[model samples]
Target chain A: MDSMIQINNLKKTYSNGFNALKGININIEKGKFFGLLGPNGAGKTTTIGILTGLVNLTSGNVLIDGYDVIKDYKITRRMIGLSPQEINLDVFFTIKELLTFQGGYFGLSLSESKKRVEKLLYDLGLEDKVNAKARELSGGMKRRVQIAKALVHDPELIILDEPTAGVDIELRHLLWNSLKEMNIKQNKTLLLTTHYIEEAEALCDEVAIIDDGKIIAQGSPKELIKADGESYINITVNKINENILSDYNIDINENIIKITSKNPEKDIPNIINILSESNIAVRNLNVKTASLEDVFLKLTGKNIIDD
Target chain B: MINTPFLTLIYREVLRFIVLYKQTIMPGIISSGLYLVIFGHALGSRIGSINNIDYIHFIIPGLTMMAVINQSYANSSSSIMQAKYLKFIEDYLVAPVSGFELSMSFIIGAIFRGVINGILIILTCWMLTDFNVHNYSLSLFFLIITSCVFGAIGVIIGIISKSWDQVGVFGTFVFMPLSMLGGVFWSVDMLPKGWQFITILNPLYWMINGLRYSMIGISEIPIMFSIIISIIFAIIFTIIASVMFSRGYRIKS
Candidate 1:
């Protein structure tokens, strides 16, 4: 598989001696929807900054489409569109004018820019705001404008840094649908850094969770859950037999039997069979499978919202 | 040939000032008009003429250069400082533009504002009084080069400033004092020898004198000397601004 972004031994030590990135490596393949998950101040923004050339790296290298980010900045920058975490809009101009200027920065002519801007306005549900200044828009509208500006130049790789950080549910759903459409139909590569683990689970093909400037786990959400997450089978019986269930990790409270297993599907039938032979009547049964959130908590030992 | 991205940045800078003309352009013209009324018409009768020219005519170049300097500095510095404060500077930082192109764009936009304001003041003088430019080419050169000098200084201040107070300090303390004592109203020779020596050291004095010579064919210093001084300051400031921008001083981390 051809990688669209390759980060090798990346490190960034800010002027105040804060080590933001500590020689971390990440590789995202072409047309892949990749997620970088971490707590606050875990070098997510710093990594994005280095990739987009906003912040200089203290050491290490980054390549976009096989071109060095610094040595061939012109080529690499043109290939990526960054929707930063901050609103950072020039509030004075209309949305159309702002996006057109963004296109011009990427070398698009006026005619081509107009075409792309109009299309993005329609796609992002911002057609009515074409003539309104950015400051006049609502928070969700401004967020949409940020995305429109990023897509105006038709870049191959789109980096969204907390794009849905403060948005409402309606807008988040709208953005997720739009992003999924682009990744699937347009074959665009997306690198998303988000605090919402469910967002990563729903959208990313693969994910890497970073903490304290180090990546602790990386894989598909299902694979990570299977490797590190635990499932539980809760069964309520009229009567319990402790001797028959001794082979499993069981916790009993009165008439309830809770068995922990890595593979709940294989263990559930065996437990039921053993119960039936022992003349134990099953009144109720519940099976709980692990989610990405469970895996994140198990590895990081902290919730995503924890500072 | 300039690339599209560079031209686009220049267009955006020029458009910003033009869009806010009531605040950016009108203030200079109105202020200069008031100066002509109070100092030129109101006080000209008592002071009479200086150096064989009408008192009103004598102050035209000085007033015009003052407007050019103030507007040029204000446009570039305020534009950049606002971008930094508002966080919109990240747009330019992430764009595919070279440092040279970005610096040149801001300087060129500032020059445009300065020249426009200077020309309007000159035209104002022509309507209100019978002042005609003695050397049009030389007057334009002074307007452009002086703007270049202040515009470059403005970029430097904008980049290094951590707060609005820092941005305003340069205008309030340094620029105002030097401009006031730079012979905008009275000739340097009118003062005593010690004061005359002090006024000549002012860079604004040379700029105003350069424009005065171009417009009225009268200057205390030689015309070539003023031109050389203006060029030297322009080169030094431009080089510094360009180098700072390329190095990403106080901008990139």
Candidate 2:
């Protein structure tokens, strides 16, 4: 697979002597929905800023579509659209005007810009708020408009820094469906950074979890969960037989059997069979499979939302 | 070659002032009108002509230049300060616009505002008093150069300013006092020898005198010297603003 974004030894030390990025490397393939998951100060926004030319890099190189971000900024910036984490819209302009201006910035003609703006607004459920100013809309409505602005020019790569942050569930699902459609049907490469682990798991093909300005783990959602995530099987029985379950890793309390297994699906039947053979008389069984959230907690040693 | 993004930036900036014309434009016209009513008419009656021209007519060009300077500076500086504080400047930063293009766009927008306000004040003078522009081209040259000078200064201030108070400091303390002491309402010859020396050192004096010379065909200093000084101010400020913008000084991290 061809890489759309290639970052090598990227480092950023802010003017105030804060180390935002400590030589991180990231490669995102074309047409892939990639996610960067990290805490609030984990350099996610700084990385996005460097890619979009809003922030200068302290050292190292970043390339988009084979063009260096610094050397060929015009070409690189023209190929990517960014929806920043902050609500930074020009409040003076209406939603239609703002999106139209954004398209114009990417070299779209007036008619072409208007057409794309209309289509994006309709798809984002912001058609009614098109004539309204950004300040007039609710927070969720403004988030939709931000997405529409990013998609107006039809850039090849889209960088969304917390696109669904602070939005309601309904709007979040709406944005998710639209983003998935763009990735699947249009073959647009998407780079997303989010605090929501489930969002990353559901939308991203691959995810890199960064902590303290370093990428701690990188893989598909299932791969990370399988490799680092822990699953548990808790079986409640009328009576516990310790010797029959001695062949397995089991923690037994008076009448309950707790088993830790890497493959919960394969181990549950075996455990049940052994209990049946030993006449343990199992009453209830509960299996807990590891998810992306669990994997994140285990890797970072804290919740993604922890400040 | 036409650059659509650059043009769009200029258009957006120009539209910003137009959308807020009540704040950006109305105050200048109203203030200039008051000066004409109270200072030009009532004060002119008490104070006779100073340089073979009527007092009311003598202040016309100075008032017009004042409009150009104030509007030009206000447009660029306020526009940038608003964008900065509101965090909408990221739109321009992320775009394909080069630093030079971004600087020029804001300057061009300032020029439009300066020229528009200058023309409106000139029209206001013609209606209220016997004022006529003696040299149309020279008057226009002064209008444009003065706007360029102040517009560039506005950009510099906007980029370096961290607060709204800092943005207003230049207009209140520097430009306002200088405009008053720049021979706007009186001739430099009326001052004492030492005060005259101090007034000549003021750059605003040259700009106001240059525009006054164009309007009334009279100036205390040579018209060519005033033109050179105005151009020098424009060039220095433009270069500083362009360099600051290109370097992303205080704007990008």
Candidate 1 wrong stretches, greater than 4 Å: none
Q: On a 0 to 100 scale, what is the lDDT of residue A157 in model 2?
A: 97
- Model 1, chain B: what is the TM-score? 0.97
lDDT of candidate 1 over B1-253, digit per residue (tens): 5477788888988998999999989999899999999999999878999998889999999899889998999888988888888787878877887777777788999999999999988998899888789999999999999999999898888888998899899999998888889988989978999999999899999999999999999999999999999999998988888887776788888
Candidate 2: tens digits of C-alpha lDDT, residues A45-150: 9999999998899999999989999999999999999998888888888989988999988888777899999988887777788899988999998888877778
Q: Give a tens-digit lDDT track for model 1, residues A100-207.
A: 999988888767898999999998889998999988999999999988878989999999999998999989999999999999999999999998888998899999
Candidate 2 at residue A133, lDDT? 96
- Model 1 chain A worst lDDT window (10 residues): A298-307
State the lDDT of candidate 2 residue by residue for B121-157, as single tens digits.
8888888877778999999999999999999999999
List RMSD in Å for every model shown: 1.7, 1.5
Best by DockQ: 2
